[model samples]
Target: MKAIREARGIGLRRLAEAIGIDPGYLSRIENGQQGAGNGTLHRYAEELNVPIKAITHEETPRDQE
Candidate 1:
């Protein structure tokens, strides 16, 4: 998350505005003090112009054949 945001030269305040979240919450996310749900995560990806898959890169795999 930090990497992508930094890559785009976006500040936490701008990202929060783009994602409709609070800057404090976004800061918590960046500092690893909080975690966001799927909906927020997707919105972050969209606002940051990155693939959803990239944002969810650490998602656990489902059990399947």
Candidate 2:
């Protein structure tokens, strides 16, 4: 996510503002400290001009096993 954003010449604050999220939260998401919901992921992918899969891979919850 950070890679795509940087490639697009966008700063964290700018992308977060564009997506209506807090920059610190976005940073956490980017750093993998938190997970983003589908809607937020879609927004990020759309803003980065990339497919949603590029940012996220569907996963089975460990607890489901």
- What is candidate 2's lDDT per residue for 1-65, written digit by digit as tens? 88888989999999999999999999999999998888889999999999777788554576368
Those runs of model 1 whose alpha carbons end farther than 4 Å from true positions after fitting are 59-65
* Deviation of model 1 at 44, angstroms: 0.4
* Model 1 per-residue lDDT tens digits across residues 1-65: 88899999998898899889999998898778999888899999998888887866765465232
For candidate 2, the lDDT comes to 0.89
Clashes of each: 0, 0
CA shift of 62, model 2, Å: 24
The reply for model 2, stretches above 4 Å from the true place, is 58-65
Which pairs, if any, clash in model 1? Answer: none
Go through the candidates in order and give each one's C-alpha lDDT: 0.86, 0.89
Which candidate number would show the highest lDDT if scored against the true structure? Answer: 2
